[model samples]
Target: MKKAVLASALSWALLAGCSQPAQTDQTIHQVNSVTNSSSVSDQTTLTAAQYSEQFIAELWQLYPEYALYVGYYDYDDQLPIANPQRRAQELAWLQQQQATISQLLETDLTDHQRTDLSLMANFVKRGIWQIESFKSWQWDPSEYNVAGGFAQIVNGNYKPEIERLRTILKRLEHVPAYYQAAQANVSKPAIPQTRLAIQQNQGVASVLGDELLAKAIASDMTEAEKIQFEQRLSDAQLAVATYIDFLTELLPEVEGADPVYRLGDTVYEQKFAFDIQSQLTAKQLYERALADQKMIHGKMAELTTELWSTYFADQAMPAEPMAAIGQMLERLSQVHAKPAEFKAAVEQQIPELIAFIKANDLMTLDDDKPLVIRHTPEYMRGYAVASIQAPGPYDAKANTYYNVMPLDGMPAEQAESFLREYNQYLMQVLNIHEAIPGHYTQLVYANKSPSLIKSIIRNGAMIEGWAVFAERMMLEAGYGDFEPELWLMYYKWNLRVVTNTILDYSIQVLGMEQEQAMDLMVNQAFQQQAEAAGKWRRATLSQVQLTSYYAGFSDILVLRDKAKQAWGEDYSIKRFNETFLSYGNAPVPVIAELMLK
Candidate 1:
């Protein structure tokens, strides 16, 4: 629940491509006169590079917070509100920039520049104007509170920055005002069940009330500041508590209402297009996912036979899906007797994983910035099966958190069974994705990229794609020393990808029932009964997000194969990976246009 605004400058870098070829003196002069005469310095004509630079600089001034997130330290304290005035101003700016880019496109530029302009124009339209008009206050208080509050606490403990914390506290103090403003300006549409509002409300109360308030009161601040912090904390706590109460009380009343507050088909299509820059419909993507599942299942069946023959030579492989899944779950549980033992094993394995990546040169190791894994906080734990929280804005140091929930409110046998399902090999697969050459590595490089613009528009497709790709890479790299159990773990990870895609389409597009989805999870993915039940709930709450990993990995593979074909003997794995990640976390299409050039 770390609230971070998209970085403006970094996003531009990722979006910018090579400019068009040199324009004739006449064309340059004509464009300069229509745009900005001042831009026509000693040079008679404006190059695409020069125009891109000027355009980005203007955008940075408009959205400085974006710059901060992208590693630009110049605008550390700025917060851009999505208010009416700001929205109007942003729209005006986008229109102006669009015109400017359009004028440049009319001139003679390289093919790369034309593609870059197309992306930039689309980016401005979708991101700036669309988001502005669609602004909802719900985003400010609820999402902002939980994301901002937890970020402060987590980072504050690791490295205390009193000034920044105070700024965040001031923001928290105004939460009521923001919420009130949102109520006044926007319609308080029925809360979407798909959103984690209930869980978020609970999280805000836990972190802001217990953790943040406790820290603020304990700090040696001026008496006035201490009192202000205490009062603000109290107000935040009440706001969150009341919201939770309201939601619970209204739940039964609204039970007959649509569970999902959808934007419907058209809006969903727009969002999909903006996110991936693809024309593929939801139906098309669903078919692809199903096809992939079928192919992978066939491969997994063969591999499972080999593994059972190797490990349990005397015993026949479990034929029933439930029995097979149960056996694996039992084996997983036997590995960790207690939480302490589990943590210790994780701690020992992380460094070894890091070392493996370094020795293989899969990615550059930031030894100066190590990753830290911990359990999910009590409040936010409900929404996520697992998550990774990046380092804060003020802190350059990188810390990666792995949040695993311990089974509670269940029978002892049930709890043990649940924990076993997430045993050693599962942990390793998670580690590869959350740490090592996955998120940690890619994020570090992204943070350090020269283009601040690329960092702000952080694409989930790239980040998740790299992690999913890394899981395959690790197995191929002889991770677990080619052990068949580990290979089974890899297939389990694949199952997650396949199930996510299926659930997204089934529930969101095909209108599949909850019970049917659960059945599919158990039968097709071999998910444990308890796990399948929980996943059904999660699928209802979060749609399409889970598909990002596999969707991204598919794109990455396409790009990788294209690179191999193009580079031939010149291709090097390290160079290809480095180049692929250099574009920041842009979508696959943007990455292709940026790097393939």
Candidate 2:
């Protein structure tokens, strides 16, 4: 990022807002006498901008890994400390910050400052709630895993090789402390989350000791320095391996592994408030998701019938389109990329998606921004098909990694099933959602926002929603020259988003059975068996996250249509896209207010 600019603005605003009284009037009565009764009230109060900057600085101190990822090098040697003491300190700090923010005078602030106050105050409160209220850090072992420390340092070219390795070695030296804290803090473990943590830690440890070290060795460093690095890496590997062992031993004794991963009704709602940042309650969202599921199914039925007549004209097919929808979906799945070609197929779709976005004038595209499609890191696989790891606001100029899972060397049947599930049509939709105008475009604008607070505390729903929205936007713009196959695939993929909300809410709150959830994915959503199975595991691993796609997409569509109606002839898709993204992934409602007014 252009740090000189961010620093100058941040330093000026924050210094004004957060500066302490120059001297605390220690000996006021000794020499100087106040002429008026209220003359001694000169304590410095931070402006909203300063408060926001202070919050970011303090947050980086607490979670240094984030600072590093966002291109802040000051605290790169440290990672998050998740022990009880750190949690308590974080909780107390948030409590103080929250109180300080509440007491600020709105009349003294600018429009941006007021919004900054709201965003940062909420950020502090959410931090407090996560530590004190919901307390997933208590059971979620994955939350405590500091396994990606080295990979983070080596993943990009944010700094010089020697400097990056210095930080890596500093962090590596603290590995024992990091895991020891995790071991001490995670008193209760969720079975699935724990198992996955252990499994991934093994991979993470290997990467840190072997893959990461090998990569770092290729960097510019002295032989003596290399030996020092190798020793530190070994120690770090031991730390992670020990953590995995601890989890493995604790797996049997830990409770809450019952296939049901729901956070009950009350907790789920509170999480929804934080995670979704929406006015709708869990019950209301569930009802909407159910309605959407049915609606999307109806749409799929129409598309499937059309596909069947075109692709299977002579075959003996069921008369009812609903009955034949499954068959048509299967036919579509048959056109998938081969196991080895899945990654290549995704890469090939990028230029096409970019072209479509440009042709439609959907939004301004930054051709100079860095984006690379690479294999998903070992430490983060088995969670999802693909992800867009956008550079943090601080690292705005760095690459946005599109991590796609590769199917190399997998068992033939598993690879084939995975390929069949993604297929070509859905891959196109997925590419649009992850690259082109989805997260990549939205996040770029976020980094450019004047207030760093917005990008720092981005709404998950907004980010996911834009990607989901992008998929629909592309389809509506006649992508693939208005191909029915594109529409059919888009509709089916849309079903995945809709069903995602239902599946997550059902499993997490309704205690929906694994079998029932799988049925919903495979039968209702038209997902392949492999795809359905992966989703079930993901739903087990997460709550409220899956809901973001549907919740966010639906809300964004509503806002866009509302804008269209309000603006009429002045309305343009390009304007809506640019304007909506300019708010830097704030909550949809917040953005709605900004756009509307």
| TM-score of every model versus the real structure | 0.80, 0.89
Q: Name the best candidate (by TM-score).
A: 2
CA deviation > 4 Å runs, candidate 2: 1-44, 105-110, 214-225, 253-258
Worst 10 residues of 1 by lDDT: 17-26
lDDT of 1 by residue, 1-597 (tens): 111111111132123210000000111222333344343222335677776666666555555433433334343333443345444455555666666677777889875566556656777766563444433233222232334333534354443556655755655564554333333333453444413556655655555666666667677666788788888767767766655565555445545434544344565555555554544665576678889887777666666666565556778778864455445544533665354455556667888897787777776677887666666665555455566655522355745555555544557766655556567777788777777678777777776665544554556666777888888987887778988777876787787777787786677666777678877887777666667767776655544555667678888888888888888898877778888877666677777766776
Tens-place lDDT digits, model 2, residues 323-374: 6887887877888887878888888888888887887788899988998888
Question: Looking at candidate 1, what is the lDDT of residue 59?
Answer: 52
Model 2 RMSD, rounded to 1 decimal? 7.8
Best by lDDT: 2
- The local distance difference test score of model 1 is 0.58
Residue 186, candidate 2: Cα error in Å is 1.9
lDDT of 1 at 471: 88
